[model samples]
Target: MAASSLFAALDKDGDGKVSASELRGCMAAALGEEEAAAIVAAADADGDGLLDRDEFLRLAREADQEADEDGRWRCLRVAFAMYADATAVEGEGAGQHITPASLQRMLSRLGSQEPGLDECRAMICRFDLDGDGVLSFDEFRVMMHDGLM
Candidate 1:
């Protein structure tokens, strides 16, 4: 991936510059606290307590090199299982089409206590390619390749 694109991914807010909190939040959201901390510490070569855009890009490149194929596949399977379960529930709309709003509602009722819209949007965007505002199986597969589960 291009360094700019990777930086955009980490930025999340589309801001012109990335702050310490933004980087920290992106890392935490993607991999949780411990892993995020480790990444920051390992990649912060200047020891300035924050990662500049170049440092973030370098770490992302290293991560791409160390890609865990098996783990990615397992994550894909788990995501598919969840999608299957969502579709199988009675009274849900027909077909494989799944909208962000509909999914947010469904997931909310399915024991996920997180009701935040950003969280729901983030989850849906992770899998919703084509900018169709919905997820099809193919889109889910692309997202699976990106390791979202």
Candidate 2:
């Protein structure tokens, strides 16, 4: 997953920690209110009802690993779902891949200085292992997990 972007979404108050409410709001659609609460409860190592970056990362990585072992792509689905939510456009095809324009917008939203289209294209080229000129979910997962972008 795009860790920083996910964290930014969860840290709704921008205080660098994810409170239970923030996590619940961010994860509710995928995990439901109760499941999200349970996740926070299990992951909050200090019983603070909040997840610091380290704690959140550990929880996410553990979840990812478990899903991988189970042959499920939960993390990738969540990452792509966030991307779609952030970049959806009217009349667009069902977005199964990340286009350069959308990626540029996503990066800018995540606080990167506005990246030029060329820069976004270059990033796609760098990670488009299939040579499709766009980033598939698998490519995105590799980029997120390996820091390839």
Winning candidate number (TM-score): 2
lDDT string, candidate 2, 16-119, tens digits = 88987788787677877777778888999988888889888898889788878666467567766555423446465457778888887788888989989999
Off by over 4 Å in 1: 12-20, 27-29, 68-149
lDDT for each residue of candidate 1 in 3-120, tens digit (9 for 90 to 100): 7876887776775445566766765556765666666788888887666777877887787766776676677666654554355356664345555555666677688884676776
TM-score of decoy 2: 0.46
Model 1 has how many clashing residue pairs?
0
Could you estimate the TM-score for every candidate? 0.36, 0.46
- The 10-residue segment with the lowest total lDDT in model 2: 81-90
Score each candidate by Cα lDDT.
0.67, 0.79
Worst 10 residues of 1 by lDDT: 80-89
Candidate 2 residue spans exceeding 4 A from truth: 1-72, 84-93
- Winning model by lDDT: 2
Question: At residue 10, what lDDT does model 1 achieve?
Answer: 72
